[model samples]
Target chain A: MKLYGKFFLINLQSQMQYKVSFFLTIAGQFLASISTFLSLLFIFSRFPEIKGFTLNQVLLCFAVVQMAFSFAECFARGFDRFPSMISNGEFDRVMVRPRSAIFQIMAYKMEFARLGRFFQSLCMLIYAMIACGVFWSLSKLAVLFLMIICGSIIITGLFLVYAGLTFFTVEGLEFMNILTDGGREFGRYPFSVYGKEVLKFLTYVVPLALYQYYPLMYLLGKSDKILYGFLPPIGTLFILPCFAFWRFGLHRYKSTGS
Target chain B: MIEVSNLTKSFRVSTREAGFKNAVRALIKRKYEYIQALSGISFRIADGEMVGYIGPNGAGKSTTIKIMCGILTPDSGECEICGRIPWKERTRHVRDIGVVFGQRSQLWWDVPVIDSFELLRDIYKVEHSAYRKTLDELTQLLNLNRLLKTPTRNLSLGQRMRCEIAASLIHSPKVLFLDEPTIGLDAVSKIAVREFIKERNRNSGTTVILTTHDMQDIEALTERILLIGRGRILLDGNMRELKQRFSRHKKIAVAYAGSLSSDMLSNCDGITVREEKMGRALIVLDSNLLTVSEVIEMLSKTVDIKDISVEGVTAEEMVVELYKAYRI
Candidate 1:
């Protein structure tokens, strides 16, 4: 961990060398997500409610999922672009070092530019929270924060699985973007909005609903059941299989070039 | 200490033919070809032995190094480095070994050289005192004091090369594998690098296995040469023994004060006049048949010699001829 921190510090200092680019990308990340906010605005303007849920409540859902994705992509950029690392001989260096490959790869690169989308989505979320006018309790608030943090881990876990698959073949990486960028796109609305069959698939197959649908239902007062808030933590378990697959992929690695 | 037996590795490469149809068909139904990189290679190096691993291109030199360094696992082989299996116990096995690829730089490009060293110290979990001791030793030996403060990107190529060598030795590994360490280096830099390596090998008794195409490096540093061609060990013997065995012809360049008639030189036995058209008379005599002293005695009796020089065949020619002899 200490070595990883030092590497990250060095990388961060190097990245900060371009002050204008850093700040501009942060601003760009903010504006890019506004289009998603606008789409929600159009739908809510017509119906005023999405399946008995108000526009503000649905907007909050959109903001939380975007926030989770941007956070993971910001810190876990190493695994996000791991194919290039292997091709460029960085992974060989990682293997020879007397440290964990994952920790080193995490510190390989960081996409601080994603902070743009993070704050952009965050602004809409705050506006929606104010408009919803829900009185918050300590337990309800805990679940909301838990949902965001746990959702990031699940998403990062999926990225790890994607990176692990690179050990075999990197020819078909675009296929995985469906689960990553595509998941974030469709996740703008609550998983329940897609109906029971799709919701169950997200819950058991990919577990996107465990963090978004069930937890959002509890936070919105649609469910008085305290257990609804606990489903996000269960979603965190999805990382285990992702990690197991990574271990298997690592053993199968055959480095190329001199 | 390293040991290996019957090591093998092959790669599946996609084949492509020249045509638009083939290129389009490759996307739908790809044809793969297998290349046998290593074919039952076996060798054992005891501690403190500097072995030169030499070979032509695509002769499995890199594949052997990769397998030993735990980067690739062999198909059917037993390799033990200090009694530890490299691919199975990769982390533990690599802790005692250091590797240097001439083309790659392990140092961080933007950070100062010392900062990269510190990061390596943490990665290797070296004790503070030991790290300092080794750093000081390497700094003094490689003359890295001035370059340590400079970022790797700012340093000159020679300066960075010296620092790269230092970075590999910071942990005082037991074995070091150098892959073309002197490639593209200036004469002075190459000598300095060679001197530092010799110093390290002499003082620490670190087993060094260097792979290079420069015959001078093999002649200067290593005693045993393992020459591989076409994924097989073509020759494995001492440098001196190969020199004595395959050095078929001896060179004799004579500068005579008086020109002799061609009839007298043609009558001499066990001599081949390699160059008669040149200003100086040159003769090639079989070393196995006649001694240099006997040839000089015979020539001096008949021809008035002003100066004469004796030379032997270089290692490069001997290796080329050896490869040809085996039809590799």
Candidate 2:
């Protein structure tokens, strides 16, 4: 944790070096994400509800996924550039360190610029809370929080796998982007709206529904089993396989030329 | 302490022909050739001995270092460092060794040099007092007090190189493996780094293994040199011993008044006349077989010797000759 903080501070200082560029990127990110919000709004203008859920409920889903996505991207941007790290001889530097490779990679990069989308998503979450008619309980609130944390971990895990794939094929970047950006775009609506097949794929394959739909159902009073609320935290274990793959990739890294 | 026997590593490298179409075709149907990076190589270094691991490029220098530092595992080999296999016992093995990859740095680029050092101290779990003592010693020896506060990216090549060396030493490992530590540094920084390395090895009894293209580094830092070519140990012996074995040829520049008789070279045990042009004649005399004074006296008795100069084989030329012999 101490090392994480030091890394965070280093990244903060590095970003602050170019204040104008940082703010511009944040604003640009904010604008880019707002289009998704606007599209959801325009769709709801024609249809009063998405399946059984109202605009308010769907907005809440959108906000939760966005929050998780933004937070994960903010922290794990290091993995996003893993290919360049290998090509630029940075991986060799990473391997010699006494610390854990994951933490060091995480500490090496932090995407503060993505905070723009985070702020926009947060505001949507607050408005959805005011607009939605669902009653709030301490257990429900806890589940909501767990959902976001688990969602972040799952997405970060996907990013880790994406990076790990770079070990075998340096140019396989676009293929992994399907999971990262594709998951985020598909995540705008609750997994159920995509029908049973899509939800099953997300549940068993990527575990996107593990954090977004199943646990979320309990939080919104769709299910009575309180255990559902705890499932999101359990979903975080998806990173295990991803981390193992990363280790495997590291073993295969024939470090590039000097 | 280190023990190794019959270490070998091979890599399967994809081969490709030229042209964009060919590259695309390779993507579709690729052929791979196996590269024997290490071919049953074996050697042992007693603790505290500075062994210069020298090799031509692509001769598995980096591969061997990686294996020794626990970054790589050989296909079939036995390596025990400090009573532990490097790759099998990576965490424990790494605790006792420090690696400085010259082209790469262990320091975080955006962080100050001191911050990197402190992080290393924590990562290594060095006791606070011991960390402080080691930091002070390294800073004083490397003259790093001024460079500590600067972000690594802002420092010049020389400044950054000094910090790179310092970053690796913060843990005070028993063995220090330097892969081209003085590469691309200005002459001044090179000497400073050399002095600091020598001092660390002498005062602390830290084992230093340096791999560099600069032969001077071997001459100054290590008495023993291990030459590798084409994934094989071609020569491994003391520097003086290598010199005497390959020191049969020495250049003698002669300025004759007019002409020198061919019979003048006949009296010498083995004299190879390299070039005899104009008033000056250049001949290579076997120094190990005949003393320079004896050759000069013998040459003077037959021809008018205006001025004469004898040159011993430098490490640079000796290395070039060795490479030529190996054809690596």
Candidate 3:
């Protein structure tokens, strides 16, 4: 943890070298996410609700997924850019370090500009908290916190899988965007809004809905069972298999020619 | 100490012709060719020995270094460094070694050089006092006091390279692997780097394995040379002995006041006249077969000799000749 703090400070100092470029990237991130928010609003303007839930309920879902995604993008940008790291021979540097390769790679890059999207999601979360009409309770608040944290972990696991596959092939695997970016867009509505088949796939296969949908059901008082509120922690286990895949790929790692 | 035995590694490279149609075909069905990078190569180095690992391009010099540094796993054979198998105990093995790739910069491009050093200190878990002492010594030896404050991108290549050597030593590793450390430096920088490396090895007994195309680096820093070509160890011997073996033939240039016929020296065995002009002649002869005085006496008999000079083959010429002899 201490080393992580040092890495964080150094990365911040490096990013601050170009002050204008840093601020512009943050603004660009803010504007780009605003278009997604506006599109969601346009969908709600066409109908009073998506499926059986009101706009405020769907807004809560969108805000949670957005916050989790932005957090992952902010901290785990190294895994997202793993292809370039391997191609440019930076991975060889990582291997020679006395630290864990994962830790070194995580410290290699941090996209602080994604905090702009994080800030926008916080505003949406605040508005949904006021308008969504959920009864104030400590357990309900705890479930919301767990949903965001575990959702971020799940997405980071997906990034890990993406990075691991790069060990076999150096080219960018564009299809993985379906699970990472596509999950964010499709998650603007609760998983139930999609049909039963998609919900089952997300629940058992990828487990995106385990955090975003089930725990959310308990938060909104749709289900009184405390078990639903605890599903996000179970979703956190998704990282175990993702990490195993990463280790397997690491063993097969063939470093680029110097 | 380092031991490598029967190490072999191969890579499967995808192949495609350079055209849109071929590219589309490759996307559907690819062909791969296997390149044997290292084929049953083996060597050992004792503690505190400076050895030059030299080879032609794509001759597995970097491959051997990568394996020793714990970066790549060999397809077969074993490499043990300091009682640890590099690939098996990678984290532990890396703690005792430092690697520098000349074509790449390990320092953070946008931060001051000291920050990278400090981060490395933390990464290696060095004590604060130990880190400070090592940094002070390196800064003094490499003359890094001025370069430490500047960002890596802002510094000149030579200055950045000096800092790079210092950064790798912030942890004071037991073994240092330098791959092409002086690829494109000016004469002064090259000498400075070579001097520092020699000093470090002498003072701390740090084992150094250097790989380079520059024979000057080998001639200046290493006593033992390991030559690899076509994925095999072609020669392993002392630098002095190799120089002696290649330096048997010597060239002598003479300036005289009178004209001398080239045929006059041709009668003597093991002597060839390289060039002849109005008042000067260049002669090459086997030093083992004829003494310099004997040749000078014979030349003085024909023309009034004014001045004479003898030269031996240089290290560069010796290496080119070696490469040609090995047919690499």
Return the top candidate by lDDT.
Answer: 3
TM, chain A, every candidate: 0.94, 0.96, 0.98
Residue-by-residue lDDT tens digits, candidate 3, A124-236 = 99999888999869989999999999999999999999999998887648889899989998999999888999999999999999989998888888888899989999998
Global lDDT of each candidate = 0.86, 0.85, 0.91
Question: Which 10-residue window of candidate 1 chain B scores lowest in summed lDDT?
Answer: B257-266
Is candidate 1 or 3 superior in DockQ?
Answer: 3
Model 3 stretches astray by more than 4 angstroms: B253-260, B263-269, B272-282, B302-307
Q: After superposition, how far is residue B311 of candidate 3 from its true place, in Å?
A: 2.5
Q: Residue A210's C-alpha lDDT in candidate 3?
A: 94
| DockQ scores of the candidates | 0.60, 0.52, 0.78
* Candidate 1, true inter-chain contacts retained: 0.55
- For residues A1-258, could you state the per-residue lDDT of candidate 2 as single tens digits? 987886787778878878899899999999999999999889999999887878888888889999999999999989988888888878666666667778878877899999999999999998997787667788788888888888999999999998888888887489777778888887878889989998889888888889988877786778888888888888889999999999898777676644
Model 3, span B190-240: residue lDDT tens: 999999999999999999999999999999999999999988899999999
Residue-level lDDT tens digits of model 2 in B123-181 = 78888999999889888888889999998889999889899888888888999999999
lDDT of 3 at A68: 91
Candidate with best TM-score? 3
Please report the candidate that would top DockQ against the real structure. 3
How far off is residue A176 in model 2, in Å?
1.6
